[model samples]
Target: MTAETAPLLELRDVGKDYGSVIALDGISTTVRAGEVTCVLGDNGAGKSTLIKILAGVHRADRGQLLLDGRPADFGSPREALDAGIATVYQDLAMIPLMAIWRNFFLGAEPTRGRGPFRRFDAARAKDVTRRELAAMGIDIRDPDQPVGTLSGGERQSVAIARAVHFGARVLILDEPTSALGVKQAGVVLRYVAQARDRGVGVVLITHNPHHAHPVGDRFLVLNRGRSLGSFPKADVSRDELTRLMAGGAELDQLAHELERPAT
Candidate 1:
């Protein structure tokens, strides 16, 4: 929130191109610790491109990305993870039939014993999973419960908790609240607040202003692959944020046209 506090992740005039298409142009925003920076956009508004760039799925074609006030170049998502940037995608990368602990430590599993005897520390995994989820204010009857059995919001909480536990300094959430019911969305938003409270910078991408406005400390609006602008929550109202994401005058014109009868 303060200029004294450096951004955990920063984009300066970042751009991405696909063949002849410009997915993003001169987009810039900052994700600061203890803050949720929400990226709001409609379909095809460059949100996906921006997330890919942040997640290291695609490299930016222009400008710079800074991490911890130093220039950073990430070749792949694994590299990004090594740099403490973790992405919790919409699908959440969870296996439906797997137990919560297994899904929690899917790729990065704990091991014990000699090489040939090495095995996943199942006991530690389940215990850590249970403990971490509880720390996030999540109460699960069983760590062995299949992740699919949890509600949408609870699954999100698990993903978030895992990222935080694994030392992710920056959390990139793609459309976190999109498919959830109102109450469920609120539950996830609260955990988002919890992450920020624990000093993890968050880049929350979503199309819903109501979902974003409540937890976001900064709002970035994108339209047709270009940034409208990034505003501090203090500088932008929820209604205005919603209105701008609707494309403002363009939406008004479309509404007027819809009201007119066909000739």
Candidate 2:
């Protein structure tokens, strides 16, 4: 892609401060359509601050957020959703007890008939939900089954499919695989690729370099509320990314400390 093809979402010199504490400083990144931009960090690496800014849960004190080459300011989560930017946190905002179809259209439901006489279109909603999930290669045994019955990876897949079906141009997924087993995490990663293949800009936030390396086109590494570096996948190897995120200096110090004789 060239500079003329602006990113679907861009954060320029973004900073977030809470009273006396600064969560991020001059952080900048971009998420392009048909690509996965992985944001890698250890705990307290300003990942939360960056996502909150993108999701409109918090506003930046400085810098600009541009969507499709236009300055964007999302006053609230709803406003962000209205702009076709959907965020799926690790928890996925799903009600496990609710049926799959119900969870699929939790906040936004389809209605039939006139305004005053409008009623939930149960049949159509369930049908659409099943079809959409199937299109994403997610085979839910039954739409009426409670969401709790689905596996962690399945739930995340449903969330991604929902976002895509709802016309989301950019999908910000916060650690979608952090809580899953190896097999389950792989499932979610496949869905991440599916979303990217469908032309949605995907922002994948994770502490696992191994998980991020395969599907990511670009990688942004953060530590102690600061960005260590950002590089295209072609420019950095997976082993290199692992070493960087693991803190090469800190690891070497620990290794030396352990090998040294007792004082």
Candidate 3:
């Protein structure tokens, strides 16, 4: 495919195993710039395994991982970050007592001065943090405030903004809205769209089809380490996606089993 049409990241028949336990099997998907691809599955459905593989924490044994249509084998998470794939886990690695700007530039703090005289450029860090958060539609009146003071959704948004600022080509978000309330969850989804609009391909991993359907361009459903299917939004309605995610026949069985007997 041409450069413009090529997916930012592609996985072909990818599979992984822990001894004899297959965690993923023949899984295939693609993440394109300016779009969100949601991976939906219940716990034990291999979602964590998938994230580990994509984040370079583990290598897929049976498939090809292509970046810009070229095969890639990442040796470590650092390698994945260097290659423009950034994964934001549920527990954001921010220091609760640290200032927002300090957390923003955490490990990669900008330095000023020379040799022994060099020190963290606090002014530049604060300015950039404010600008970047504003760009993401996050208004923080005081970036000097402790990050722990921010709400969960705000924390998630800050993580996303940080990824975007650091040049993440493919953003993998692991259940960002899982612990959030209805309103807070909405806040995080908004930033997910913002990232996509900025031409960063986003892979949103979640079990909630409700959250995934609204912002997703495509969906890949997994169950027990296997793919139910990959579908475009046009091909799958929100209700249909919900049904598939809820385990179709199994859900039906559950409902029937829970029904009260007629008097």
Can you write out model 3's per-residue Cα lDDT over 95-180, one digit (the tens) per residue? 88999999999877899999899999999999999999999999797999999999888998999999999999999999999999
Question: Residues 72-176, candidate 1, lDDT per residue (tens digit)?
Answer: 999999999999999999985578899999999988999999879999999999999999999999978999989989888888889999999999999999998
lDDT of 2 by residue, 1-263 (tens): 74579888998888889899989988888889899999998888899899999999999999999999899999999999999999998895689999999988878999999969998899999999999999999989999999898888999999999999999999999999999999999999999999999999999999998999999999998887777778999999998888788787987788888895978
Error of 1 at 125 (Å): 0.5
Q: Total clashes, candidate 2?
A: 0
TM-score of candidate 1 on Cα atoms, chains taken together: 0.96
TM-score of every model?
0.96, 0.96, 0.95
Error of 3 at 93 (Å): 3.6
Model 3: which ten-residue window has the lowest total lDDT? 1-10
Which parts of model 3 have CA positions greater than 4 angstroms off? 1-4
